[model samples]
Target: MPAAAHDLRTPLTVVLGQAELLERRLARDPSAPVDPAGTSASRARRDGCETS
Candidate 1:
């Protein structure tokens, strides 16, 4: 139905937008250093997973 399609499309569009943003962030700057383990977002994800 049209309503169901609309419901699914909105979230999919948001997810695609966020993925694009993340891809841009991760593309990185050549002059900056990259640390895989030290980001606060990674720390939060690790902590959240451990608690669950």
Candidate 2:
């Protein structure tokens, strides 16, 4: 099911990219309150809500 795989790929990529960016930002500014896991986008993802 290439179509199903592709559908999953985009969102997974988005989540992974966001995580990497957050990781870099935290590395540079450890005191920042921008927690990736606490973000609205991440919350919706964890709750199985549509991000779009």
Candidate 3:
């Protein structure tokens, strides 16, 4: 099921990329506030794949 594996990998890649970006941003400015909605969306994308 390569297609199914690809579908799952896509979202996980996105989540990881977003997390990396967030990490870099926080590193630059540790005082910056994280957006709750953005965090929720990332978690949703991650969880969505797990439930599939």
| Top TM-score model | 2
CA lDDT of each candidate?
Answer: 0.56, 0.67, 0.67
Candidate no. 3 TM-score = 0.55
Q: Comparing 1 and 2 by lDDT, which wins?
A: 2
| lDDT tens readout by residue for model 2, 1-52 | 9888779878876886686577666668867776546854456567765534
Better of 1 and 3 by TM-score: 3
Deviation of model 2 at 42, angstroms:
16
Tell me the tens digit of each residue's lDDT in model 1 across 1-52.
9888777767756655565566457657565566667444445445542221
Query: Any idea what lDDT model 1 has?
Result: 0.56
The ten-residue window of minimal lDDT in model 1 covers: 43-52
Q: What lDDT score is found at residue 51 in candidate 3?
A: 31
Instruction: Judging by lDDT, tell me the better candidate of 1 and 3.
Output: 3
Per-residue alpha-carbon lDDT of candidate 3 for residues 1-52, written as tens digits (9 for 90 to 100): 9999888888867776777677667758968887765654466666664433
